[model samples]
Target: MDLLILGIVVLIYFLLTGYVGYVAWRRTETSEDYMVADRKAHPYIMAMSYGATFISTAAIVGFGGMAGVFGMGILWLVFLNILVGIFIAFVFFGKRTRKMGHNMSALTFPEFIGRRFRSRFLQYFGGAIIFLGMPLYASVVLIGAARFLETTVKIDFGIAFILIALIVAVYVVMGGIKGVMYTDALQGTIMFLGMIFLVVSTYYILGGVVEAHQALTGISNLIPAEAKAVGATGWTSMPVYGSPYWWTLLSTIILGVGVGVLAQPQLIVRFMTVKSNRELNRGVLIGALFIFVMTWSAYVVGALSNVYFFRKAGMIAVEAAGGNADKTIPVFINSAMPEWFSYIFMLTLLSAAMSTLSSQFHVQGTSIGRDVYETIMRRKGDRSVLITRVGIIIAILIAVVLGYILPGSIIAQGTALFFGICAASFLSVYAAALFWKRATREGAIAGMVSGALVSLFWLLFEYKKTAMALGVTRVIFGGPVISSMPWPVVDPILVGVPVSALMLVVVSLMTEPPSREHLDKCFNGIKGV
Candidate 1:
C-alpha cells in the first residue's frame, strides 16, 4: 500500500513537470528563449522559481540532520535566508539585473557580469568558476534526494541517483528556464506543505511542544560529559556557544548559504528571466513567505526529532547513524511518519532535488554554451540554440561523474565554498554595475581576480574544516589552521567579499570610468529596451 501511494505521487509529478517542459519548449524559438525564457516570465513564476532554486534536498536532509546534532542554533540561518536571500535580494539586486540584462541582450548571469564591464575575461572566468564549484554542491543535493528514496522504497543508492538525474536533465534540456520555473512552482508547493506537515506531526508525536521540551531538557542531567562536549543540550535549545557544532553553524553553514544567495547563478538568473521591476516587486512577498515556511518548518522539526528518537526509541539518531549528519533527516522521516506518509515525503524530497537540479543544470549550460563559448571561447557568429541543449547533457554527465567520486566530508561542508567564491568573485562587480556610475573595466577585473584567488586559497589552506569535510586523498596544506580552535579560520565571504569590494573601488579610482558613450550603451535602457 505504501509503495502504491509513492508510485502514484511520482507518476503525477513526472507528468506535470514533463507537460511544463513541453509547453516551455513549444514557446521557445531561439537560444535566448531557451536560456532566459525570452525574458517574459510573470511575477508568480519568478517568485516560485527563486524559492525553489534557493532551497533544496540538502536543507531537509543535510541541514536537518545537522539540526539533530547542533540543535536550534541553525535557525539563525533560516532567519537570514528569508531576509537577505529573498527580500533584500529582490529589492536591491533583481530589478537592476533585469533592466541591464534586457538592455545588453544578455541571456545568462555570466554574460550579464561580462557585458556590464565590457570584458570577455570576466565572462569566461565566471563561467569556469561556476562550472567548477556548482558540481560539488550539486552532487550533495543529488545524494540528499537519493538517500530519501533509498530509505523509503528500498532502492539502491546508485539507481536512485541515476533516475533522478535523468528526469531533471530531460525537462531542462527540453524546456529551458521556463520549464525549470514551472516545475519549481509545483515542487516548491510540495516542499512547503511537506515541511509544515512534518513540523506539526512531530510536535504531536512528541506529546506537543511542552512535553517535548520537558523530555528533552530532562536528558541534560543524564547526559555524559562527552555528549555535552559534542554540544547537545537536551535537544531543545541551541548548542553550546562556540563548540565545533556551534562554530560550523556560524561560519560554514549559516554565513555561507545565507549570503551566498546573492551570487548563485541559478537564483540570480531568475531576475534576468522576468520582464520588469513591477514583476520583481510583485514577486517579493510570495517568495519570502514560501522560503520562510520551507526553512523554519524543516529546522524546527529536525531539532525535535532528537527527543522522538532518544526517549521513544532509545536510539540516538546521530550517534547510531555513524556520524553522517546527512542521513539523520531520512532516518527521522521514516521513523516518525507512517510508512505511507513517508512515501509522500519521498516524492517531496525528489521534487526538491529535481527542481533545484534542473535550474543548476540550465544555468551551467547557458553559462558555458552562450556566455563562454560563443561570446568568448568561440570567435564567430552565435551558435545555434541546440548547442545549449547539447551543453546541458555534457554538464549533467560531468556532475554525475563527480557525484560518483564524491566524498563524505565535502557533502558536510554544504554550500560554503561556492558561496564564499561567488560573493568574492562577482559581488563587487555586480554591485558596481548596478549602483556605481564610476565603475571601470579594470576595477571589475581586479575584483574578480582578487575575490576568486582569495576564495581558492582560503578554502584550500585556512579553512581546514572544509578540507576535513572534503575527505580528499591529499591535503596540500595538511589541514585547518586551528583544529584546536573548532571553527573555520577565515570564512571565504568575510575574507573575499570585502577584498572584492575594496578592489573594485580602488581600481576604478586609479583608472578612468568607461567613456560616457559606452556607459550609455549598457545603462540607458531602463525601460528603453
Candidate 2:
C-alpha cells in the first residue's frame, strides 16, 4: 500500500467525520438533544445507528477472528443478533421502553429504570455498574481497531490506540448521542458496502461459494490436535455435544452475547431516541438486513480464510496469526485482499470501532454525570453535561490503558465476558421494569445486586477464561478454577441470569408491590398493549 494513498484516504475520512460531528453539535442546543436526539430521530438513522452500535469491531475483528479459529458454528450468534437483538428488541422491548421512558421523562437508561422503580439507589447502582464495567468492553473495541491498523499499516499499537480513542472522544464529548448516531449512520453505510465487497471478493478468489465451503469441509482432517481434543469437529460442523468446545461456543460465545444484548444500556437507550413505535417498527427490517449482511459476511469470510491460508501458507487461521484469534481477521485481510480493497476495509473497521466506542463512551459518561453524580448531588444542567464530557475523557483513557495491557486472543473473550456480566446484572431487572407490572423497587435492587455479585464471583473463581487470567482463584485455591470441567467452561450468564430472575420474582412477591399510582404513571397509555 502506498503511504501517500493511505494518508489521503485517512485524512478524507477524518474530515468527513469532523464535519458530521460539527453538524450534530450545532443541532444539539439542549440537554434533550444531547441525551436522546431530542426524541425525534429519523427511522433510517435510528435503525442504522442501532445496528452499527450493536455490531462493532468486536463483531468484525474480534468475533470474526473467533470464526477463523472455531469455524462457521459461531454463525449461531448472527441468527441471535438478528432475532433477539433486532426483532424482539425492537418489537417487544423497544416500543414499551420508548413509551415508558417518555412517560417517566427519563433521559438515560438508568434514569428510566430508576424512575420506574422510584429508587435513587437503583439509579446510582446501575450507573456505577456501567461506569466501572464498560471499560473492558470499550477497551476491547479499541484493541480490535488498533490491531487492524497494526497489521495492515505497520503502525505501533499504542499510537493506533490513542488515535482511534481521541477521534471518537472528541465527537462524543461535543455532540453527545446525536453526534454518535449521525456518525453511526455514515459509518454503518460504509461497513455495509465494505462487507458486501469483502464476501464477494472472498468467494470469487477461492472459487464459488460451493467450492469454498466444500474446500473447508475437505480439510476437516487438518483440525488442530488441541482443538480436536476439546471437541472441535471441523469448521463446517458444530463441536461435539457436552464437550469443552461446545460449552465455550454455546454458553460463552453464543448465549453470552446473544441473550445479553437485551440488557445493553447503550442499545436500550436507542429505543428511546426515535419518536414512536412506528420508527422502531420500520427499524426492524433495516436493522435485520444490516446485521445479516455484516455478521454473515464476516463469519463466513473468517471461516473460509482458513482455506486461503492453508492453500498459501499450509496453516490454519489461528496458527497463521501467531496463535492470537484476535489477529486472524486483520492478518487475513492484510495478506489476501488487494491493496485498493484493503483501504476500504480499513475504513470499514474504523467505522465499526468509532461508532461503537462513541456510544460506549457516551453511555459511560452519562452514567457518571447524569445517573450517578446528578442523582446523588440533586443537581442538573450544564454542570452535569460538563461532568459527562470529563467522564468521557476519563473513560477513553481507561480503555486506552486496557488496550495496552490486555493480552492477545482476548478480543472475543473480553466482548463475551462483558456481555455476560451485563446480562446477569441488568437483564433481569431491566426485563422486569419493562414488562412485569408487579416488579418492585426492593426486588429490582435485590436482583441486580445479587446477579452482579454472583456473576463476578463466578468469573473470578469458576470461569476458566477469566479466573485463570486474573489468578485470584489460583492464589486462593491453588488451581486455575474452583470448579470441575463443565462448570468451569459454562458461562456465568447461565447461573447468574436464572438466580437473578428467581430473586426478582420471589422478592417482588414477598415485598410490597409498587404503588398503584406509580404503576399507573409508568403504564399510562400502554395499559392495553
Candidate 3:
C-alpha cells in the first residue's frame, strides 16, 4: 500500500518538473533564452537556483554516507558551504559577474572570460575543460539519486538513472537557465521539506533527540578494531587529531566542496542572472538557513543511525550494510523509515539530482552549442545557434550513457568527482577575473591549462589502476594494500584546488596585466559610476 503511494508521488514530481521545462520551452524566443533565460533572472529565482546547484543528493547522500563513517565533524563543512558558497559567492563574485557579464556581453563562462581578456583561445579552453569535467560530477549526482530510488522503489538502477537524466535533459535543453531556475525553486522546496521530515521522523522514531544522542554515544566500544586501528570512532565522538580521516575530511570533502564553489562555471553564472547586489544580499540569509538545515540534519542523523541499527540488528549499521561506505546512509534510511516516507524520500533524492543535473546538462550542452561548435570552431554566428541545439541533444545522450558507467573512477561518485575537478580547475581564473585587476590573458591560459592538467595528473597518479594491478592500493600516495588509511575516503579536490589557485595567481603575476583600457571597460558597470 505504501509503495503504491510513493510511486504516485514520484510520478507527480516528474510531472511538475517537466511542466517547468515546458514553460521554459514555450517562453523561449531565441537560443539566448534557451542558454541563459535571456539573463533576466530575478533575485528570488536566482537565489533558489544557486541553492539548488549547491545542495544536491551529494550533500544528503554522499556526505551523509561520509558522516555515517566519519561522525559529526563533517558538519563544519556546512558552515563553509553557506559562507563561501552563498555569502561570498553572491556578495563578492555575484555582483562582478553580473556587471562584467553584461559589459562583455558574454553569455557563458567561457565567453565571459574569452571576451574579457579578448582571447578566443581562453573561450575554447575554458569550454573544453567544463565540457570534459562536468559530466563526471553530474554522473556522480545521478548515481547518488538513482541508488536511492532503486532501493526505495525497487526500480532497476539503469532504468531509474536514465529516466531521471532524460527528464532533466529535456527540460534543460528546452528551457535553458530560465527553465532550470524555475524548476530549481520547486525542487529546492522539496529538498527542504524532505530533509526536515527525514530528520524529524528519525528523531521521533528514536524516541527523542536526547535519547538518540545518548544511544549513539553509549556504544563507544562497539567500534571495530579495524576502525580503531585506522581512524574510526563513534559517530558521537571526534576522530583522533592528525588522523588520516580528519585530514581527508578537513582537506578533501570539506575543503573541496567549500573552497571549490567559487569556480563552478554553472553556479558562478547564476550570480549573473540576478539584478543587483541588493538582490544577492537578500538571498544570503535564505540560502544559508536552508543549507544549514538540509546538510546539518543529514550528517547528524547519519551519525545517530548507529544506535538505530544496533538496537534493531544487534550490530552497527555499517556492519549490517556490508561495510561498503556508500551503503551506510541507504541502510539507515531503509531501516529507519516507514514505507510511506520512501515516497517522499524518493522526491527528496530526485529533487537533489535534478537540481544539479539540469544545470550540468544545460552548461555542458551550451558549451558545445554556443562556445565550441559555434565560436571557436568557426561556424557562422546564426549557424552556431542551430549547432547548439544539436549539441544539446548530443550532450544529453553523452550524460545518459555516462549515467550508467557505475562511477568506477573511485569507490563511488556517480558525479561528485566532476564537481571537484570543475571547482579546482576553473575557480582560479574565475576568481582572478573578478577580484584581481592585474589578470592577463596569458596568465589565464597558463593557469587554466596548468590547473586542469595538474588536477587530472594527480588523480591518475594517486589512484592509478596500474598500482591496483600490481597489488597496491595507491600508486602515488603509496602505502599498504589491504589496510585502510586513517581516512578511508579520498576526494580529489584537496589535491587539485590549491594547485589551480596557485597556478592562476603565479601566472597572472608573471605576465603583464590586461591593458588598462580593458580594465576600465570591464569595470564600467560598477555602481554609482
Candidate 4:
C-alpha cells in the first residue's frame, strides 16, 4: 500500500512537470525567449527559481551527509549563503548585471563578460571552461539524487541516474529557460514545505530542540581518534582553528562554495531573467527565507542524527552508511522517518536535484551553442536554439557517465571544487566588468587564464581529494599530495582568487583603458550619462 501511494504521487508529479514544460514550450519562440525568458519573469517565480537553482541535492544530500560527519559547524555556510549568495548577489551584482545585459543585449553569462570586455577570446575561453568544468558538478548532483532513489525506492543506481538526466533534458530542451524557471517555482515550493516538515519531524523525534543539541554535545568524547588527530573538537563545535580539518572546512568547503557562488554562470544568468531591478529586490526576502530553511534543516538534522542513530543502532551516520558520507541522509531518512514522510522527502530530494540539474544543463548548452559555436560561426536565429538543444543532450550524456564513475564521499567536495574554480577563473574579472570601468580587456583575459590555470594546478597537485581522484599523487608521487607546503590541505581558492585579482589590477593599470564609448554604454544607467 505504501509503495502504491508513493508511485501514484511520483506519477502525478511527472505529469504536472510535463504539462508545465508544454506550456513553456508553447510560449517560447525567439532566441531571447529561449535564453533569458524575454527578461520578464515575475518576482515570485524569479525568487523561487533562483533559490531552487542555487540549492541542490548537493546541499541537502551531500552537505547534509557532510554535517553528519563534521557536525553543525557547517552552519557558517548558511550565513554565507544568505549574505553572499542571496543578499550581495541580488543587491550589488543583480542591478548592474541586469542593466549591462540589457544595454549590451547579451544572452548568456559568457556573452555578457565577453561583450563587457569586447573580446572574443575571453568569450570563447569562458564558454570553453563552462562546457568542460560544469559536467563534474552536474555529475555530482546526479549521483546525489540517484543515491537517494536507490536507497528509498529500491531502484538500481544506474537506472535512477539515467532517468533523472533524461527527464530534465526533455523539458529543458523543449521549453528552454522559461520551462526551467516555471518548473523550478513549483519544485522550490515543494522543497520548502518538505524541508520544514523534515526539520520539525527531526526535532520531534529527538525529543526537543534544546534536548537534541544537548545530546549531540554530550557525545564529544566519542570523536574518532583519527578525526580528533585532525582537529575535530566535536560534532557541535568548529574544528580547532588552523588545524588540517579546519582548513578543509573553512578554506575548501565553506570559503570555496561561499565565495564561489558569486561567479557561477548558471546562477549569474538568473539576473538577466528579470524585467527590472525592482523584481530582483522583491525576491530578496523570499530567496533568503527559502535558503535559510533548506540549509539549516539539513545541517541541524544531520548533526542530530548522530544522537538518534547511536541511541537506536549503536553506530554513527557515516558508519551506518558504510563509510560513505553521501549515503548518510538516505540512511537516516529510511531508518528514522516514517514511511509516509519518506515518500514526501523523496520528492523533496528529487526537486532539489532536478531544479539544479536543469539549470546546469541549460547553462552548459548555452555556453556551447550560443556563446562558443554561434559566436565563432557568426550565426543566429532558430538554428542556434537547435544547436543548444543538441548540446544539452550531449551534456546529459557526459554527466551520466561521470555519475557512474565518481568515488564515494565525492558529492559535497566535488561541488566545492567546481564553485572554487568558477570563483578563481571568473569572479575577479566579472566583478571588475560590473563595477570597475578602468578594467581593460587585457586584464580580464590575464585574470581569467591565470586564475583558471592556477586553480587547475592546485587541484591536481595540492587538494588531496581531487588528486586522489586524478590518481596524481598515487601515480606520480606515491603519496597524498605533491606539494611540500606546510599547510597542504588548503583549498585552491585561497591562492587562486588572490592571484587572479592581483593580475587583474596590475594588468589593467599597465594596459590601455576601455574606449569611452564602451564605458559610456556599460555605465549608462548607473552614471545617468
All candidates: CA RMSD in angstroms?
2.7, 0.8, 3.3, 1.2
- lDDT per residue, candidate 2, 49-73, as tens digits? 9999988999999999999978999
Best by lDDT: 2
Give the CA lDDT, 0 to 100, for residue 345 in model 3.
76
Candidates 1 and 4, the one with greater lDDT: 4
Least well predicted 10-residue stretch by lDDT in candidate 4 = 479-488
Among all candidates shown, the one with the greatest TM-score: 2
Note the Cα lDDT for every prediction shown.
0.79, 0.93, 0.75, 0.92
Clashing residue pairs for model 1: 409-469, 410-469, 464-480
In angstroms, the error of model 3 at 396 is 3.6
Q: Give me the displacement of residue 506 in model 4, in angstroms.
A: 0.6
Superposed by TM-score, candidate 3 places the C-alpha of residue 156 at a distance from the truth, in angstroms, of 1.4
Q: Model 3, 1-112: lDDT tens per residue?
A: 3766766776787889888878877888776666667877777777778888888877777778777777777888888888888888877888888889888878888888
What TM-score quantifies how close candidate 1 is to the native fold? 0.93
User: What are the per-residue Cα lDDT tens digits for candidate 4 across 1-529?
Assistant: 2788988999998998899889999999999999999999999999999999999999999999999989999999999999999999999998899999999999999999999999988888999899999999999999999999999998999999999998999999999999999999999999999999999999999999999999999988878899999899999899999888898899888998988999999999999999899999999999999999999999898888899998998878788889999999998999989998888999999999999999999999999999989889988778989889999999999998888888999899999999999999999999999988899999999999999999998888778777766877677878878766444788888889999999999999999999999888877877433
Per model, state how many residue pairs clash: 3, 0, 12, 0
TM-score of 4: 0.98
Better of 1 and 3 by TM-score: 1
Error of 3 at 185 (Å): 0.9
